[model samples]
Target: RIIEGYDGLGIVSTIDPGQGLVVVWVTPDTQDEVTHILHFFPRALNY
Candidate 1:
């Protein structure tokens, strides 16, 4: 699913069933803006 920020910044967070990993894609400019997205999925936890 895709989640967007209040400012219209966002990221596409998806679980790659075949890879067994959560893939996150965002624009280079919004790399820092994706912190919240990363937090939602916690890098410490497994996808």
Candidate 2:
């Protein structure tokens, strides 16, 4: 899903509700991407 900020700056993050896995696209918005992923999956991490 695409998550947009209050200023419209956003990133695309995919969340697998069934598997409870949130996949985030890392590029320009690496920080935003991670934030988005965590927003969807509070316990998500690379490890």
Candidate 3:
């Protein structure tokens, strides 16, 4: 659901959501933006 609003920022391709195995793909240019966005999550998801 997170990636739904931030389409160009990143993508989440997880075969099994229950396993908590979420694959996030972010390009080099989008790294800073991704990091900034993740900060709002209270470090719940760290790369």
| Candidate number achieving the greatest lDDT relative to the actual structure | 3
Instruction: Please state every model's RMSD to the true fold in angstroms.
Output: 4.3, 5.0, 1.9
How does candidate 1 fare on TM-score? 0.39
State model 1's lDDT.
Answer: 0.56
Order the candidate numbers by lDDT, best to worst: 3, 1, 2
Q: How well is each residue in 1-47 modelled by candidate 3, as lDDT tens digits?
A: 66557879888788577877777788999889877877787547757
- Output the TM-score of candidate 2: 0.30
Backbone clash total for model 2 is 0
* Model 2, runs deviating above 4 Å: 1-10, 28-44
Task: Give one clash count per candidate, in the order shown.
Answer: 0, 0, 0
Clashes of 1: 0
Error of 3 at 6 (Å): 1.5
Q: Higher TM-score: candidate 1 or 2?
A: 1
| Overall lDDT per candidate, in order of appearance | 0.56, 0.52, 0.77
